[model samples]
Target: MTGTPRLDDPHAFIRAHTALMAPPMVPEVELHLAVETVAIWEQTEEALGEMGLPPPFWAFAWAGGQALARYCLDNPAIVSGLRVLDFAAGGAVSGIAAMKAGAATVEACELDAFAIAAIETNAQANGVALTTRLGDLVGTDDGWDVVLAGDVFYEAEPARLIGGWLETLNARGATVLIGDPGRSFLPQDRLERLAEYTVPVTRDLEDREVRQAKVWKYR
Candidate 1:
């Protein structure tokens, strides 16, 4: 299977914790991927263990992504029959959501091999077919009707880089939707609020903090 990556045990922590929802086993219209998350401003040394990375900690299923997932699941009208791209998609929740909502195709883009592997496993666990692409938004050109990003503006450098890429995409007339739960560097003025929601997490979830996340569009 050229597209199917190997699956592994990504739920050790979730299995230990009951609050977390197991990835649904049935193949259905909607799919959900268990993403990783770290608390806001936690030391990189402490946070990298879970994600297998260093400072500029890597977190997944952040509230912003959760909100977008919720919105996509609830609004099939928007995603149905469209080609969707989930940018820097750690868990691929938004991409899966779009697939569930009837998007013609869902692609998960991430630079980390581990994250890509995680998406591969979760997509199968949820019974939805997804495509994986190893891509970085900073200097990559991908054609997508809607470029979805979740909680990607937590740091200064990534924020600037992704922002610049988004600006270029916007200039070319692509719809860019960002989901951020008020992370320190979220560019608020540049987007229009689409929706908001509260997200839950496991005990190990660093931030362990649930916040209101919003979906904003720049089209």
Candidate 2:
């Protein structure tokens, strides 16, 4: 339990390291999430033997994602019959919510291999179908009708790149939605608020029990 986990079978690794549960804000759909944040981060770092690897963001249901998923569940009409892209989808929470809300199709895109496996597992657990895309999809347009991005504006550089790309997508008439808990780099001036939620979160991950999360549409 102290050493690196074998990642040859990412599915098995995810199943062994996480539990199936519902996020607090969106209980209608279940996800495979890590019970302990630090433990999973340490384990993944050890397994990869690299300190530069990103933290296990996919292992937890972030406040922003929870809020976004809740909005999708409450207002199904927004996504019904539209092709959606869950950009930088961590655990595919919003994507699963969209599918349950009657979306025509959902593609959950992530760069982490473990995230890809977790997305597939979470999709199946909720009995929702999601297409998993593994890579950096920035600066690319796939002609999706609706694009959902949750908790993606945490850092400066990535936020800059993704924000510009999202603006481009919005200009092209694709409905781009962003969910965020007021992260440091969120482009507030370029977004129009759609909805807000008081999302529950774990202190180990967010340093608080609740967060004021908002869903925004690019304007």
Candidate 3:
């Protein structure tokens, strides 16, 4: 009787696996987050019946995402009445903040189906609406006025590709913003710092109780 849960019902999985809670840096918004990192990661792989699938990043509010969401909420003019894209939007924290800050529209894109489900459920939990796109939107541009990416510079190849794309977007008149907590792959030289925050995080995930995360604008 204990086989894998149906992968098609991601919303059910999300609801069953996570708790609806607010991130410490941005308490105005709530997300479905896993309490214990290892348990959720193991459960996700078990349920998917796959060994090499990506970790359940959607189940935690990383420091970078918390910092970015805090920035958006504190400075509403950055997203007010503009079209915003939350790229690699794990649980759509920044996107939800944009909507709360008066963005005209918010589109959250993620490569993981579970992330998409988490985003949708999180949006609903906060009483906001967000358009969800499930796919790899790395090289595409949909004419967003502002693009927000949080916690995306952890890997080398993706960081290289997305850094180039974000630069291109900035050159083409899009306001591109990035949030990161001093990750190894961040293109620091190409960005200008805007704001910083001390975000609380679980030690199991970040190895520290607090992280110094920053918001940067592509230059």
RMSD to the true structure for each prediction, in A, is 6.7, 1.7, 1.7
Pick by TM-score: 1 or 3, better one: 3
Candidate 2 stretches with Cα past 4 Å from truth are: 2-5, 50-53
True lDDT of residue 6, candidate 1: 22
Q: Let me know the TM-score candidate 3 reaches against the reference structure.
A: 0.95
**Model 1 TM-score relative to the real fold:** 0.74
Q: Which 10-residue window in model 1 sums to the lowest lDDT?
A: 12-21
**lDDT by residue (tens digit), candidate 3, 1-219:** 155346778898888888999999988999999987888888886765563446788999988888889999999999999999999999999999999999999999998878898999999999999999999888899999999999989999989999999999999999998999999999999889999998888988788889999999976
lDDT for 132 (candidate 3): 99
Q: Order the numbered candidates by TM-score, best leading.
A: 3, 2, 1
lDDT of each structure? 0.65, 0.89, 0.89
How does model 1 fare in lDDT? 0.65
Candidate 1: where are CA atoms >4 Å away? 1-60, 202-208
lDDT, residue 161, candidate 2 = 98
Q: Which sections of candidate 3 miss by over 4 Å? A: 1-5, 49-53
Work out how many backbone clashes candidate 2 has: 0
